[model samples]
Structure formats: C-alpha cells, structure tokens
Target: MTTIVVGVLGALGLVSFFHLGLFDLSSLLRAASNLRQFILETFPPQFEILPALMHAIWETIQISFAGTLLGLFLSLPLAFLAARNLFGRWVAGAVRLIVGGIRTVPSILFGVIFVIAFGLGPTAGTWGVALYTVGYLAKLYYEAFEAVDVEVIEAVKSTGCNRLQLFRFVIVPETANTMISQLLFMFEYNIRASTMMGFVGAGGIGYYMVGYVQMLQYQHLLTTLILTFLVVMTIDYLSLRIRSVITVAKN
Candidate 1:
C-alpha cells in the first residue's frame, strides 16, 4: 500500500509538472477575465443567421448519411470474409490488418487526404467520413458476425446452404437489427465529426466557425455552436428511441 501511494503521487507529480504547467494565479485570472468578456460579447446569439446555419446543418446530415451508407456497404463483404468461421486464417489476418491500419489513422487525416485528392468541398468530406467509418465499423461488425452462434450456423448448413447462402439467410438475419442499430449510432458520431471536416476544406459548418473566429463574430460563433449542440442532442434522443423499438421488436 505504501508503494502504491508513492507511485500514485509520482504519477500525479509528473502530470502536474508536464501537463498542467506552472500554477500561476495571474494567468488564471487573465484567462477568466477573457472568458467573461467573450461571453458578454456572445449574448443572445445572432438569430439572423438562422438560414445559413440551417443549411450547414442539412449538409452535415447529408455527409453523415452518405458516408455511413457507403461504409455499411463496403464493410459487410469484408466483415464476412474476415470471419474466422468463414475464411482461412491467413485471409482473415490480412483483412484484419488492413482494417486495423485504417482505424489507426485519425479521421481528420482522412479529411485532409480527401481534400487534397478531390479539392475543397462536400465531396471530400463525404469520402473522408466514409473511409474512416469503414475502418471503424468493419471491426465492430466483423466481431458481431463472428459471434453468431455456431449451432445456428451449423443448423443452416445442414440444409445444404452454401457459404453465401448461409451468410444471407442465417448470419445477416441474426445480425440485421444490430447492424441497423449500430449504423444509426455511427451516423450520430459522424455528425459531430462532419462539423469539423470543414476545417480541412472538406466542407460543413466548420468554415463558418472559422470565419466567425477570424472576424471576432462571437455572437455568430455562439449561435453556430448552439445549433450544433441541439442537432447532436436531437440525434441522440431519436437514436435511443429507435434502438429501443428495434430491440423490443427483435425480442
């Protein structure tokens, strides 16, 4: 216990030394004053920019939907091929390696690459979100596919079903509800990600956010931020309701 306490104190000390920097009261007070001034400038938010904000919100939804659909389409085949029950060890390992590598890459990097490839706009953002989602969702879905009960798979096989038939009729059926539910969750996550894609010229509300910051339009910036928060909350609430209904139906 004494050794553990010392170790914990050492860890905290290192974190304070490196991460927190010096505890300067003057710096803290200055930051707080700046924050107060910023808030005062942001009061009531610029309601006049509602149309532009709405349009950006719509575009964000579009990017998320398109990307998630693309990921789902691409992930399904790769997931089955990577399933140990369906493929040889070498094939599965190679596929998993590729997927893992993709997941290791940051999403913003994907946006940057796509912007370079396609030039600035929604196209770049859509592709970026799609590629990242493929990397992320494939791993989750492959695991779900692999977890399908062996007895159920064998039962289907006894009917003389081929591998493709087995997946279509048995595995997919068993996992369809889960797949749809997860896709909605992915859409919610991608909405937040899409907002920042515009920073790389990939497109969305982020450009306006940049503009507001550059112009010192604190009111407009606060409005944009609030809109984003509301949209995310709405998505979360809707996703929860939909998933609950799906779960009940599946049961």
Candidate 2:
C-alpha cells in the first residue's frame, strides 16, 4: 500500500522528490468574487423560454437515445469478436486496438468533426455520441462476455451449433441483462454529452445555453440549467428503478 500510495502521489507530481510540481489552489480564492457575482445574477431562472427549452430538451433526449442505440447495434458484434475467450487474442487484440483508438478521442472532438460533415445539428451530436458509446461499451461488453461460464458455452458448442447459433443461444442470453444495464447508464451519459454538443452548433440545449451566457441573460441561463438538472435527476431516478426491476426479475 505504501508503494501504491507513493506511485499515485508521484504520478500526481505532488512532490518534487519524484518530479516537477505545479500545485496551485490560490486561484480558486481569487475567483470566489466572480463566482458569487455570477451566481447572484443567475438565480430563479426565467420561464419565458419554456417552450423553446422544452424542444431543445426533446432534441437532446432523442439524440442521446438514437446515438446509444446506434452504438449498441454496432458494439454487440464487436463485443463478441473482441471477447478473448470467444475469438482468441488474434481477433480480440485487433478489435481492442480499434476501440482503444476511438476511446483516445473525446466525444466533443468527434462532434467537431461531424459538425463539419453533418452540418450543425443533432446528426453530428448523434455521431459523436455513437462513437463514444462504441469505444466505451464495446470494452465493457467484451469483459462481460469473458465472464460468461465456460461450461455453458462449451455445452452449447457441443450441440453442433454454428457460431451464430452459439451466439444466439449462449452469449446473448448470458449477457442481455448486463447489456441492458450498461445501455441505460450510457443513455444517461449521452444525454449530458448531447446537451454539451450544442455548444459547437451540433444542436439542442447547448446552443441556447451558450447564447444565454454570451448575452449575460443569467436568469435564462439559470432556468436552462435548472431544467437540465431536473431532467438528469429524473432520468437517473427512472434508470435506477428500471435497473432494480431488472435485477429483481433476474433473481
């Protein structure tokens, strides 16, 4: 544990005994006045823009749902191929490399690229969300695939089943619950990201958010933020409930 702690601190550059340091907490104190001023100006958000805000919220939800589904459709196959136990290292390694490369880039960066191609809308945001989902969920799914009982897989194999039959009967059933759980988690995350994508003209609430900020319409900004917070919390609650139901049904 001492070695692990030392390694962590060293990596954090917390001590010049290990490497150079750049620790600075004083700036936050300096920014306190600005933070206070911003908060004071932004409270009790305006409800005048409720209609527009609702539309934007809907767009964000749709973008997130579509993007997550797109990722799920593609990742399911990739997950199977990337499962080391199923496909061996030769296949898994290549898929991992591709996935790892995608994961290296941020979703916002992907949005930047897709915005240029798809031209300033939810399509770009969806593409960005999809790629990130692929990168993130494929790895998760492959891990889940690896954890499936070997005996069950072999028993299915022994039935003279082809690869498709094996995947259908063995892998899909074993991992369906895990995949659903991950899907809900990813959809929640995608909603947050898709909202941010609007900052880049990729479409949805972010556009309104950035506009409100630029105009110093802090009340409107506050309102938008409040709405976003409510949406997130609601989704989180619903997702928790759904997952609980799934878990109970499984048990």
Candidate 3:
C-alpha cells in the first residue's frame, strides 16, 4: 500500500511537471478576461454565409463517406489474409506488420502527402482518408475475425469445409455485425479527420476555417463551428442508435 501511494504520487508529480502549466491567480484572471473578450467578438454570427458553409460541410461528408467505402473495400482482403485463425502464423504476422506500419503514420501526414501528389483538392482528401481507413479497418476486421468462436470454426472444418468456405459460411456471418459497427465508427471518425485535411489544402470546411482565422472573421468562424458541432452531434446520436439496434437484433 505504501509503495502504491508513492508510485501514484510520483506519477501525479510527473504529470503536473510535464503536462500541466503552473497556474496562478493572475494567470487565471487574465485567461478569463481573454476568453470573455473572444466570446464577445464571436457573437452575432454571420448567418449570411449559411449557404456556403452548408456546401462546405456537405463536401466534408462526401469525402468521409467515399473514403470509408473505399477503405472497407480494400481492407476486406487484407484483413482476411491477416486473420491468424484463418491463415497460418507467418502470413498473419507479415500482413499485420504491413498494417501496423501503415497505421504508424498520422492521417494528417497522409493528407499532406496526397495534397502534394494530387495538387490540392477534395480528391487528395478523399484518397488520404481512404488510405487511413484501410489501415484502421484492417486491424479492426482481423481482430473481429479472430474473435469468432473457435468451436464454431472447428465444427465447420470437421464438416469438410475448406478454409475459404469456413470463412464465408462461418466467420463472415458471425462477424458481420461487428464489422458494420466498426465501419460506422470509422466513418464518424473520418468526418472529423476530413475537416483537418483541409488545413493542407486537401479540401473541406477546414479550408474556410483557415481563411476565417487568417482574416480574423470570428463571427463567421463561430457560425461554422456551431454548424459543425450540430452535424457531429447528430451523426454521433444516429451511430449510437444504430449500434444499439444492432445489439438488440443480435441478442
């Protein structure tokens, strides 16, 4: 118990030393004042830009959806090859290593690379999101595939089913719902990621956000933020509802 307390105190001390800033009464008051001024500047949002904001947000949705679909298509085969339960250890290890390497790079870096290659547009953003999605979904899929009941797999194999047939008839069916759930989660994540892709000129509402910051258009920026918040919240709620329904159906 004493050792545990000492470790906890040391961890807290390190966190405070590295991650947190020293806070003083004056610093807090100054921060509060700055926040109040910023809020005042942000009010009376520019409703006139609603049409443009809507269009930009729609583009973001398109990028995310396209990327997620393309990623899902690409990830399926990679995941199948990476499943240790389906394939031998050597094959699974090699495939998992490739997937892990892909995942090691940040999605934003992928966006920057695509932007450079494609020369700045939604095209770059879409491809970047797709590649990132492939890495993520492949990992999720293989894990889900591996988690399918061993007894079921063995039972199917005992019936003289080939490996491919086993995967098709047993593994796929058992993991289909989980696959859908992960896909939905990735789509939701990509929406937010797509917004950042615009920073590198990959295209999305983030481009407008950058412009607003540069031009000091606080009112318009606030309006854009509000719309984005609402859209994200709506997507989150819908995803939760769908997942819950899927769970109920599975049960």
Candidate 4:
C-alpha cells in the first residue's frame, strides 16, 4: 500500500510540474495584457451598426440551421450502418472509415476549400460546416446505438421483423432522445464555427468583425461582440428548453 501511494504521488507531482512549465504564467500574462488592450479600445460600441449586425446575425443563424439540418438527416441512415452490432463487419468498417476521414479534416480547412470552389458566400460556409457536422453527429449517434438495450433488439428480431422494421420499430425509438441530444450539441458548435468561417469570406458576422478590426473600428467590434453574446445566449436557452422537453417525453 505504501509503494502504491508513493507511485501515485510521484505521478501526480510529475503532472503538476508539467502543467506549471507548459502553461507558463509569464506567457499567459502577456496574452492577457494584449487582450485587455483590445477590449479597452472596443468600448462604447457603435449602436448605429445594429441593422447591419442584425442582418449578419440572421445569416449566421441560417448557416448553422442549414448545416445542422443536413447533418442530422444524413446521420440517421449512416448511424445504423456504423453501429457495430447492427451491420456486417465490412459495412460498419467502411462507414467508420468514411467518418474518420471526414473528421480528420478541420472545419476551417473545409471552409477555405469550399470558399475557393464555390466562391465567396455563405454557400461555402454552409457546406463546410455541414460536412464537419456529419462526421461529428455520426460518431456520437453510433455510440448511442451501441448503448441501446440488446434484449429489446433481440425481442424485435424474434418477432420476425426484418432489418428495416427492426430499425424503425426498435432502434429509432430507443435512440431518438440520444440522437436529438447529439444533434443539438452539434448545432451549438456549428453556430460558433459558422461565425468564424466568415473570416475566410464565407458571409457572416465574422466577416464584419474581421473587417472592423482591420480598419481599427473598435466601436463596431464592440457592437459585433454584443450581437454575438445575445445570439449565443438565445441559442443556449432554446437548446436547454428543447432538451428538457425531450427528456420529459422520454421519461
């Protein structure tokens, strides 16, 4: 017991030392100083830009919504195939490989590539975010499927139900809540990613933020920050409400 305790303490001490060295306090202080200066300069926001900001906010919402909707729909079929217990080994392996390939590419890179391919607009941003979302949702969804009760599945199979019937009557209902939860989480992430995609000329509030910062339009930057805060808060609240409703229904 003494040897085990000493080993655990030694491991923890190494971790602490690593954190102290890797996360150097001096470097953090320098970054914080720059951030403070930026915030100070952005005070007294430009309220006049509210109309334009509102328009940009709407575009961001549209991008997130479109991407999330497409990802959610596409994931439904793919999730079943990817679930190891539900499909043949080859089929499941292929689906997982595709998902892994998608995940390996960053969303920002996707945005850049689509921007070049589709030209400068939300089309590029929407598609980029959607592709990323597909991989993200599929991974979580397959896990949810794997977690469902095996007894329920076997019972449905014994009832002479085919694969499609089993999926519809047993799997879908059992995993519906988990799937919806994953989708909502994806939308939350997409909202932030969609905003950042605008920096690559993909059409959202991020485009305006980048422009304002480049021109030293600090007041406008502050306004953009305010709009982002409001939008994020609203989405978070709605997500909570939806999650609660789903939980209640499931219970």
Query: Model 4: per-residue lDDT, tens digit, 2-42?
Result: 99999999999989978877568888899899989888888
Considering summed lDDT, which 10 consecutive residues are worst modelled in model 1? Answer: 17-26
Q: Ten residues in a row with the worst lDDT in model 3?
A: 17-26
Instruction: Tell me, by TM-score, which candidate is best.
Output: 1
Q: State the C-alpha lDDT per candidate.
A: 0.88, 0.88, 0.91, 0.88
TM-score of each: 0.93, 0.89, 0.89, 0.85
Q: Write the per-residue lDDT of candidate 3 for residues 85-132, one digit (tens) a residue.
A: 999999999999999998888888999999889998999999999999
Tell me how far candidate 4 lies from the true structure as C-alpha RMSD in angstroms. Answer: 3.7
- As a TM-score, model 2 comes out at 0.89
Predicted candidate 1 versus true structure: per-residue lDDT over 44-141, tens digit per residue? 79888988789888888888889889888988888888888777899989999999998998888999999999999989999999988989788888
TM-score, candidate 3, is 0.89
Candidate 3, residue 117: Cα displacement in angstroms equals: 1.3
The TM-score of candidate 4 is 0.85
C-alpha lDDT of residue 179 in model 2? 83
The clash number for model 3 is 0
Query: What lDDT tens digits, residue by residue, belong to model 2 across residues 1-251?
Result: 99999899876665663343234446556677789989898887788888879999989899899999999998988888998878879989999999899899988898899999999999999998899899999999999989999999888898898877878888889988888988999999898988888999898899899999899999999899888999999998999899888888778
